[model samples]
Target: MASTVVVIGGGYGGISVAKALDDIADVVLVEPRETFVHNVAALRAAVDPDWTERIFIPYDGLLTRGTVLRDSAVRVRPTAVELRSGTRIVADYIVLATGTRSPYPAKLDVEQAADGAAKLRATRAELARADRVLLLGAGPVGLEFAGEIKSAWPDKAVTVVDPAADLVSGRFPDEFRAELRRQLGELGVELVLGTSLRELPGTDPGRTGGFTVTTGSGVEITADIWFPCYGAAIDTDYLGPELRPARRADGRITVTTDLRLPGQHTVFAVGDVTALPELKMARAAQAHAQVVAENIRTLLQGGGTLASYRPEEDAIVLPLGPKGGVTYASEVGVLGAGPSADLKGGLFLDMYLELLGAVVAR
Candidate 1:
């Protein structure tokens, strides 16, 4: 019998690995969402309603011979993946690539693309009515959201509240940090770092209303709308205790150097579900796919040297909007808006379309 590789997740890493092994192996991709969400562009979608449609791409045309299971994985055993409907898919190898979730606007809570887009449109209406926008969380999502909001409505007052004293400081270079602050200032975004809100808003986030929040420093600020941009809840409940033993305390899985779940060559994990001491970004997940793909290929070929995976260099291409952002690479160090926009600002949709071969997330 031919080898069967079941991939449980249709996110960036899952899609890439499944596509790579489409014809060579009996690839089975299991996921719940109707389409692949280009989550990196989510903030932009929140501000630019027209771009919302492009953030979701169906999985219809992604694989040539591999099967795409449009269902949820309820339990993953050693050799089979059990769905919520109790259907079991026996596999020679399994790839656990289930990703995480973020706040709405940054990530929609819906399963279908249309519903997700509708939510974005509704939030856009709220955003348009609100004058003062408060963003809680200073991570990439928050910063990027502030940039998107400002880029769309330059006159709107945007405040970003973060508990960290510096922007991704200590992780990257000082020049990178300085440039980020400079760009935020140029865009008229106010930063209230080193503190947090004394109390969360009485109203729900992403809702339109008038409310004032007190900060830990006793500074009072009122806003018509606010959004919580941080918090990444990983999806891993499907793994029973036997499978759950592979997961770390943070809900991420412990993988071998070759990306396989320890003690089980037939099981592997990747993407936001992996316990890598790096920012949970799409790029890192894609890197995980490369290693997992190679390792699986070797095992299928009757065993060979499995490739090892390590954190890639400090590389990031953070888009502020369609026209601005920041990026860093070992080849170029940290760069300004021009390079950032050139790499990510323009190619966001086209790149995903190319990845999935113009398939809808169906």
Candidate 2:
């Protein structure tokens, strides 16, 4: 009999690993959301609701030979996973891929997945009525949000404020950063780098409304609304005392080179749940899938040797809305624009969904 591989969380990494091992093992994917939200396109969906419909991929058609459970894992032991619904699943190997969470609109919730796409579409009406926008945090999420806003509504005032002295500091080369600044300037996005916010004078900090935000530089920028694009809270509350002493500095579970917990080969972790020093993006999750899948295969085949996962030092890609963006690799940068953005950046969400056998409209 083939070994049962239970994969927790239905994010990019979980789904990819399950799909790859569907033919070789009895794969069980545990997730609470009825539909998997393509988080990569969540920012774009926030800017344009029409894009939201394509952001969610239902798991019903995902695996031809595997099974998907519409429940969340509350406790994960070495050989089994206890569901929140009091159900239990015994497995030969357990792959934990429970990713991080952000704010509501930024990251869709499980309940929101029901009609979250529709909610994003409805938000289009709200975003269109607003004239000025305030985005806190100059990280990739904030930068992508700004890019999406500029692409959808160029006339709207978009200001990105960050406490960091430099935008995308040290991650991208100097010339790449300059190019990013140039693009932001051409798109009419006001970059307010190296600044702190005193407070927001808006009534609805979550919703778009006429508001004024004061900065540490004594300049107040007024906007219709502001969004928080900083800080990521990882979802690792399920792992009990069985694996507590192996967390890295980033609050992520520490894993070995083979993506397995040290001294716990039966238990593996991937995606944002791991303590790797790589960017916690969907693309990185995909890369993690390839490594984790091979290790699982080796373990299932009697464990000759496990493969190690080495994350690329400089693998970064910023999709600036639907028209253009940038990609950085190994100290070199490439500007992705026009068809390139639509082909790779835009459809990346769709492509992965399709690869997972989800219903994705071209």
Candidate 3:
């Protein structure tokens, strides 16, 4: 009998691994959403609501041989997974791929889709009515959002606020940061660095309204709207008491070199669920799929050596809207509004999504 592989969380990592092993093993995928959401396109879709339908793809067409379970996994033992609907599935090898969570609409629950759509529409209307826009945080998401807004409405007064003393500090070289500042200036994006918001101004966060925001350094500024852009929270409450130590101080699971839970070789973890010392991105989840599929394959082919998974140190590529962005490939870091943008913002996103059997026809 072939080995049964039960993979939970049909996100980037889970789907990739299941597709890779569907032909070789009896693969079972557990996911909650009816469609696979191409998150890279979600932000852009928010600007052009017509393209929103394209970002959602039906998972039925992804893996022909694998089984898809449109349910949530509530418990995971060494050998099986218990679904929230009280369904239990037994497997020879188990993979825990339940990733993290982000702010609403971008990566929140499906039920919030209506709220997200309404917020996006309101934001667009607000942007049309307002003269200035303020964004909190300089992370990739915040920067990308600012870039998209500027590209769509070049005349709008756009300002990015971040407490970091330097933009993308320690992530890029001085030259790159300087170039980014120049580019933002050229785009009329006022960047207020080294300033922290003491309190969130009371106003329609998604609407055009007058609001005053105070910074940590006593710098006061007023804007029409503001958004909080921060890191995501990893969801692991379903793990229960299987691996107590898996939850690190930062609330992430720790995996071994082979991507398996330490001391529990039969069980494995991947994607945002693992406490890997690397940036949490969709590309990283794809990389995890390669290691996970290979390891599972090795386990099924009798006794064999398993390849270890090592995350790249400086693999950061940020696409800033549809025309520009930055990329840090190992020691070489390149910053511009062209190379990174054209690659990801233009065509690469669609290509990557198509590769995963999810694409929106333009």
lDDT of each: 0.86, 0.80, 0.76
In the range 1-362, model 1's lDDT, one tens digit per residue, is: 67999999999899989988887799999987888888888888888866778888878889999888889898898898899877898889999999888888777788888888898899999999999999998878888899899999999999999888877633688888788888999999999998999899888888989999989987888899999988889878788667788877778888888888888868989898888777788888988998889888888888978899997666777777777888877788998988888898753677779988884342
What RMSD, rounded to one decimal, does every model reach? Answer: 1.8, 1.9, 2.2
Model 1 clash pairs? 34-361, 35-361, 57-361, 58-360, 58-361, 59-360, 59-361, 59-362
Return the TM-score for candidate 2, rounded to 2 decimals.
0.94
lDDT of 2 by residue, 172-289 (tens): 6776677677778888999887888897555654466787778899878988877788888886778867766666656689988888888787888889888888777777787888
Model 3 over residues 234-343: C-alpha lDDT tens digits? 77777757666677876788999999988887888889889898878888888988998998888888859998988766556665667777776655567466677755
Q: Considering only N, C-alpha and C atoms within 3 Å, which residue pairs clash in candidate 2?
A: 209-224
Full ranking by TM-score: 1, 2, 3
Best by lDDT: 1
lDDT of 2 at 59: 88
Model 1 scores what on Cα lDDT? 0.86
Task: Judging by lDDT, tell me the better candidate of 1 and 2.
Answer: 1
Where does the lowest 10-residue lDDT sum fall in candidate 2?
331-340
Report the error of model 2 at residue 236, Å: 0.9
